[model samples]
Target: MLQRLKLLEHINPGAAHRNVADSIPPPQLHKMSLPYNKVLVLGATSGIGLAYAEKIVEDGKKAIVVGRRKENLDAFVEKHGKDKAEAITFDITQVGTIPNFVEDITKRHPDLDCVLLNSGIQRGFDFAQPETVDLDVLDLELTTNYIAHVHLTQAFLPHLQKQSKQTALVYTSSGLALVPSVKRLNYCASKAALHHFLLCLREQMKDGPGNVKVIEIFPPAVQTELHDEKHQPDIKNGRQMGMPLDEFTAESWAKLVQGDDQIAVGMADRLFALFENTRQQQFQKMVEMMKGH
Candidate 1:
């Protein structure tokens, strides 16, 4: 606990020990229209979600804070003005309720233009201990990390297309999705699936006329309660063990504010480069094989 506290101190807003990596946005991408008026943030009470909420507050923006815990939700609204910080009690793992929940948000806050799907979980697995695998844990990770977001997005997309203002549907997919990790097999697999799903969904929106924009955030190993305390898998971090939360949040927020549709932070660049290179090489080999046939 003390070490975590100290590590955070090293990268506080004005701290000198900030680890800024050169994780640039794709060359063709534009800056995001940030400082949202009324964005709905899923998993607003913890980790990267919490940091992003704080960023919104700093920008004097309003958000509907969604979380599973009533107490935490209450505290956030009370601390920040009730008018600015609204609360919604939602357990996204309850997939059946997502459509209704999306309807409620749209009806209640017509001004809401952005929906940030940042809720996720990471659970480790050992293939050797096959008997120890908990089906409940595996199910929760899959449902929360991927399926829930898909349902929510599908529900809100039509409404977003109808809105006059430009709207965004943001998803936080881990860098692990592109680069596999044996420690959290299901978690990685789910993110990978979600990543691909978003690509297809984005393409569909592009094919038709829609006000909605799709944004994907690929986070590296950011120091968060979930990553540090919960399933601390050995996700390789370059330059530092794990990026300090302040540094990660600042860098990520900048990218979003700049209007980037897709962004990667810290060591996520390594994963992207490796994956793209491998894909290109495989494509070339496949082409050579086709020539022989």
Candidate 2:
């Protein structure tokens, strides 16, 4: 215990006594309106992102789909109609360009009320055979999944906060975030980091101005192109794995419309419940103790 205390002090000398404010929003405050008519969806070229974009358009809402592939972007716009959907070619891994990109998009579409960050990549790693792990792939996975999302949030937050009506910053995390998959080391770790980041962001936003809601959707391994069968040969027929895209989308969309800030579907729901039941109370106690200090 003494060693642990010393380690904590060494990590951040001033952390224990820092005045941490309560970050919990009231239950009534959470049930705000879903007035997000125009949404900006990152990584909407395919998979879960494209499914969400299609759903948004189907609901008569405007969806601005962003992806790295121009061909895919053009195809989405062509299918959805330009009136209901707009497409932008963007690579989220280009962290340096994110601010300007956000600036341009916000200026062009000032009515954009919601931003959905769903871009991510997954790769398998075996630490036992360290030689098989590609460091480049590992870095890219982390960047695409977690780092880029943080940058995008920072860039768009100011604009979202300026809106008079309710606005949202939505994230598509995974059930693996709560209960990690051992083989997909970086993928699971990135999601875990993102989950914690969302928690901190919510607390900070609770104390800030404007109604910029932070919503998170936790998906169980849905039928998507996230897993690369070509590269990760062990995972065959990747797209056929996990929950069906339509089923997951239907359930998640329902929860989103019902104003659930944290939407966990299927297996993710159970994992979320188990994790939160044990950890949330302890987290609240820690927060209270810090504030008292």
Candidate 3:
């Protein structure tokens, strides 16, 4: 009788374990694939954009870097070798000229599969000191940072859609959009607008038939010369504040290749999670605080 009871208990437990295992589904396998061979890096003359370009070329892929500065573009191409990298000079702020610019580039490299919109400007402003914020500077900032990016996306959309394989459109926004910096009202607003724009585009793409992937990168302060030529005394040096350029770039590159839709490096990643949890309330409060209400 004792032996029978022990055998019964063991049999029941084994049956239960088998049932549980059967109920749980097996892990699905993802089909790994390479999407594209050629890429375009807009505003590749400096900062994160430049780093991304270097990374792509180092991976033994073709990179076409677009920027306004001929010297900077030339220097990058020379460093990377002409066989792997190409440079094109075009000012994104010139909206009327972008159609032609897009046509020329697409004609030259019909196989282009990725476009990274990284051109932007940051200006420090004092709402209390309105004299520091000139209308010309404000216009320049808006045109370069926001308006031109929209035009470039519009111009590139049709070409990207025509490709049979998956294409990627990447935008470099800022962490300031999540937590506003009082000194850079224009820059923050522009990035906030971009964040919304890309979100909407992602939604629209879902409803459409195109396989184009939209990605947004929010980079925390890195060592770059974005504010140096502009001569902003109050602007904190990014190098002194946090992560070095190479470290930030390495992490960012890894995220991009791993198919992360929204990439944030270092402190920015933590901040992004916080922003996601408290977005609506935090954004509203930021607006009110910036307005001095």
lDDT ranking, best first: 2, 3, 1
Model 3 lDDT tens row, 1-293: 76765676787755533555687889997733335578899999988889988888877788899998999999998998889999999999889999999999999998899999999888887879777678888888888888999999999998888888889899998877677788888888998888878876875676456678999998887777766534566755643555677988888887888898888776668886776547746755765576543
lDDT of 2 at 83: 96
**1 or 2, greater by TM-score:** 2
Clashing pairs in 3: none
Q: For each predicted model, how many residue pairs clash, with residues at least 3 apart or on different chains?
A: 6, 0, 0
lDDT of each: 0.80, 0.89, 0.82
Against the true structure, whose TM-score is highest?
A: 2
TM-score of 3: 0.81
User: Where does candidate 1 clash, by residue pair?
Assistant: 30-259, 31-258, 31-259, 32-258, 32-259, 32-260
lDDT of 2 by residue, 165-245 (tens): 889999999988888888998999999999999987887788668888999999999998887597667899998999999
For each candidate, give its TM-score against the true structure. Answer: 0.79, 0.86, 0.81
Error of 2 at 63 (Å): 0.3
Cα-based lDDT at residue 286, candidate 1: 65
Q: Which ten residues in a row have the lowest lDDT in candidate 1?
A: 230-239
Q: Supply candidate 1's per-residue lDDT for 192.
A: 89
